[model samples]
Target: MDFILLSILKTAIAAPVLLGTLAYLVWIERKVLAHVQLRIGPSRVGPHGLLQPIADAIKLLTKEDFIPSYVNKFYYWLAPWLALMFAVTAISVIPVGPVVEVFGIKTNMGQADISIGLLLILGLTGMGVYGIALAGWSSNNKYSLLGGLRSSAQMIAYELPMAMAIASPLLIVNTLNLREIVNAQAGYTFGIVPNWNVLGGGLQIFSFIIYLICAFAETNRIPFDLPEAENELVSGYNTEYSSMKFAAFFMAEYCNIITACSVATTLFLGGWHPIIPNELGGQFLPTLICMFFAGVLFYHALNPSRPSDRLSMGVIGAVILGLGLMFQVPVVKDLAQPLFWFASKAGFLIFFFIWVRGTVPRFRYDQLMRFAWLFLFPAALLNLLVTAFIVAVKSN
Candidate 1:
C-alpha cells in the first residue's frame, strides 16, 4: 500500500516536471541551433521565445486531428501513443539522485528502483520502435512504410553494438540495478580523478564512445538520421500524421534523447557524484554554477541583446540568483546538490546532441548500416571481451 502511494506521488511530481522540461528542451535546442548558425531563434514568440513551447502546444491541441480514409484506423491511432508511452516509461527506472525524505515520506528520486532496472529500460526502449513500424504499415503510403522499415532496420542494426558497449561498463560496475550502478561509480583517484567508467575506474573510453555513436542512431539524431530524411521520404512515416498525433511522435523523440542522456550520465559519468570530493567543497559547486549563470543572465539583461530582453532577462537572472542562494540552505542543499550534479551532466550530454545536429551532415542509409554492422559491432564486442579479461585478472 505504501509502495503504491509513494510511486503515485513520485509520478505526480516527476511527470509534470518532465513534461515541462520536454517542452523547453525543444526551445533550448532551437535557440542553441540558432546561435550556432548565427541567427536569433524564437525571439518573436515570447521574450527570447520562452513562450514558444506554449505556443506550439496550443497550436497542436487546436489543430484539426486529421485522419486519412485510406489509412488503417486502429493501428494508426495506436502508433504515436505507443511511441510516446514507451519512450516516457523508460525513464522511470533511472536513478536521478540518492534517496531522500520529505514530510515523513522516504523514497528515491525516480519511479521504480528494481534490481533489473537496466533491463527494464532496455526492453521499454526496444518496444518503442514497434510503434514506428506499425505507423508506417498502417499509413497505406509507400513513404510512411519506407520510413517505418528504415527505423526498424536501424534499431536492429545498432542495438547489437549498443548492448555490447553497455555491457563493458556493466562488467566493471557488476550490477543491473541503476541506483547500485550509480553508487558503484563513486570516489576519486588520488583525490582528484573520478573513478567513472570512461576514466580511471574502468577506462571504458572506447565503450563510452561506441555507446554514444550508437545512441545517435538509436534516437535518430543527425549524422545517422536516415529513417526520416525528409528530402527522400517526404517527411517519412510522420507525413500523414497531424495535430496531436504528430505532436506525440515529436515529444517521443525528445524524451528518448533525454532518456539516452540520463542513461549515459548514470552509467558512464558517475551519476549524481560531483567531479571533485566533498572535502574539497564539492557541495558548493552547484551554488557557484547557478550564481555564475545568474551573472551571465543579468549581464545580458543589462546589455539588452535586444531591448525586449531587458526586463525578461533580468527577471530570469534574479530567479536564478535566488535559486543559487537557496542551495546555501542546509536542508535544501542536501537534496538539491545531487539533483544538480545529475542534471548538469545530463544537460551537457543533451547539449552535445544539439551540437552534433547543427554541425554534422546526415549519413547515407547504406553507410549508416555499414558503419554499425562492420565497425561499431566488432569494436563493441572486442571492448567487452577486453574489459572482462581485465576484471578477471584484477579479481584474481
Candidate 2:
C-alpha cells in the first residue's frame, strides 16, 4: 500500500511537470532559433514571453480538431497519443538523484528503479516508430506515407549505432540498471577530474560522441531530420494533424529530446554527480548560479524596458534569491543539490539540441541513411569493441 501510494504521488508530481516542460521547450527552441537569426522571439505574450507556452497551449486546445474524410480516423486519432505516451513512459527509469529520505520515506527521485532500465528505454524508444509510421499510413497521403517510411527506416538504421554506443559505456560499468551505471561513474581521479564514463571509465569519449550523434538522429533533430524535412515532405507525417493532436506530436518530440539527454547524462556525464567532488565545495555551486541569475534579474528590473518587467522581474528575482539562500541550509542542500546538478547537466544537453537545430541544415535522405550505416555504425562498433577489450584486460 505504501509503495503504491508513493508511486502515485510521484506520478502526480512528474506528469504535470513533464507536460509543462515540454510546452516550454518549444518556447525555448523558438527563442533560440530566433536569436540565431537576429530576431527578438516572443516578447509580447508575457514578460520576456514566459507566458507564451500557456498561450500556445490554449490556442492548440481550442483550435478545430479536424479529421479528413479520406483518412483512417482511428489510427489518426491514436498515433499522437501513442507517441506521447511512450516518450513520457521512458523517463520512469531515469534517476534524477540518489536515494533520499523525504519525511521518513526512503525513495529515489525517479519513478522506477528497474534492473534492466537501459533495455527498457531501448524497447520504449523502438516502439515509438510505430506511432509515426501509423500516422503517415493512415493519413492516405503520399507525402505522409513517404515521411512515415523514411522515419521508420531512419530509426532502424540509427538504432544499431546508438545501441552500440550505449553498450560501450555499459561494458565499463558492467550493469544494465541506469542508477548503477550512474553510480559507477561517481567520484573523481586525483581529486580533480570526474570519473564520468566519457573521461575515466573506459575513456569512452568517442563512444559518447557517437551516442550523441545517434541520439540526434533517433530524436529526428536537424542535420538528420530527413523524415520531416519541410521542403521535401510538406510537414511530413503529421501534416494532416491539427489542434491538440499536432500539439501531442510536438510534445512527444520534445519529451524524446529530454529523455535522450537525460539518458546521456546518466550514462556518460555522471547523473547528479557534481562536476567536482562534493568536498571541494561543488555543492555550493548551484546556490551560486541561482544567486547570479537572481542578480541579473534584479539588474534588468532596475532599468526595466517593459512596464511589466518592473514588477514581474523583481518578484521573480527575489524568489530566486530566497531559494538560493535556502540552499545554504543543511537539509535543503542535502535534498536539492543532487537535483540541481542533474538538471543543470541535462538542461545544457537540451540547449545543445536546440543549438544544433539552429545551426545545422537537414541532411538529404540518402546522405542520412548512408552516414548512419557507413560511418556512425562502424565507429560505434569499433568503440564498443575497444571498450570491451579494455575492460577484459583490466578484469584479468
Question: Highest TM-score: which candidate?
Answer: 1
Highest lDDT scorer? 1
**Cα lDDT listed for each candidate:** 0.92, 0.91
Q: What is the TM-score of each candidate against the true structure?
A: 0.98, 0.97
lDDT of 2 at 366: 86
Clashing pairs in 1: none
Residues 278-348 of candidate 1: C-alpha lDDT, one tens digit per residue: 99988888889889999999999889867877999899999998998887898887788888999999999
- For candidate 2, the per-residue lDDT at 54 reads 97
Report the Cα lDDT for residue 198, model 1.
Answer: 88
lDDT of 1 at 14: 95
Q: Which residue segments of model 2 deviate by more than 4 Å?
A: 305-308
